[model samples]
Target: MPTISMFYGILVSMYALDIDKHHLPHIHVRYNEFKTVIAIPDGEVLEGRLPIRQSKLIQAWVELHRDELMADWFLAASGQTPFKIDPLR
Candidate 1:
């Protein structure tokens, strides 16, 4: 997994050639011990859990960078390194 962005103690990443689970454009988020897979298009939690505050932050970040995320997803699915996205400020 390669980290694509980080903000407010949240780490966002994408795995290259990842397709078996969460077969959609998504991101893996981690904040402290909590982690979750979130769908990129809708900011829905596809797996795992996070604090409500962290979850909201993730959704807002996703919404702010949906296009970049989708592009990264395509690159990652094809086993290419994804471009780093700007962190939420």
Candidate 2:
């Protein structure tokens, strides 16, 4: 997993050629011991959990970077390393 962004201790990544899980454009999030798979472009929680505050921040960041995220997803799903995205400030 390659982290594309990190903010407030949250690490966000997308696996290259990942398709078995989620089966859609998504992101993997890690914060402390919590983890989550969040759907892209829509900000849906596909699986797992994160802290409430962190979850809200993730949603907002997703919304702000939806376009870039989708672009990165395309590259990632095709087995290319995704570009780093700006973290929520």
Candidate 3:
């Protein structure tokens, strides 16, 4: 798994796997016992479950670091150096 970003110990990561014969541009968010994927760029939750508060936090993080997340996802998919998003935003 590649880590795209981190916020308050919550990690946004991605893994390369063929889903239905096509590679999807999505990333996973892991916090506590929560694990889920939110589609890149749009920040749409696709899998697993996150509580409302946690979900909001994830959304804000994704929005503030959209560029880094996308770049990291690409890098991870291409086997390049996985990028870490700045938590400065």
Per-model root-mean-square deviation over C-alphas: 0.6, 0.6, 2.5
Model 2, 1-89: lDDT tens digits are 99999999999999999988689899999999999999996899999999999999999999999999999999998999999999999
lDDT, candidate 2, equals 0.95
- Better structure of 2 and 3 per TM-score: 2
Candidates, ranked, lDDT: 2, 1, 3
Query: Model 3 — which ten-residue stretch has the worst lDDT?
Result: 16-25
Number of the candidate with higher lDDT, 2 or 3? 2
Error at 28, model 2, angstroms:
0.1
TM-score of each: 0.97, 0.97, 0.78
Candidate 1: where is the Cα deviation over 4 Å?
none
> For each candidate, how many residue pairs have backbone atoms clashing (under 3 Å)?
0, 0, 0
lDDT of 3 at 10: 79
TM-score of 3: 0.78
Overall lDDT per candidate, in order of appearance: 0.93, 0.95, 0.72
Instruction: Identify the leading candidate in terms of lDDT.
Output: 2
- CA RMSD (A), model 3: 2.5
Query: What is the per-residue lDDT of model 1 for residues 12-61, given as tens digits with 9 covering 90 to 100?
Result: 99999998987888899999999899999888889999999888888888
How high is the lDDT of residue 33 in model 2?
A: 98
lDDT of 1 at 41: 88
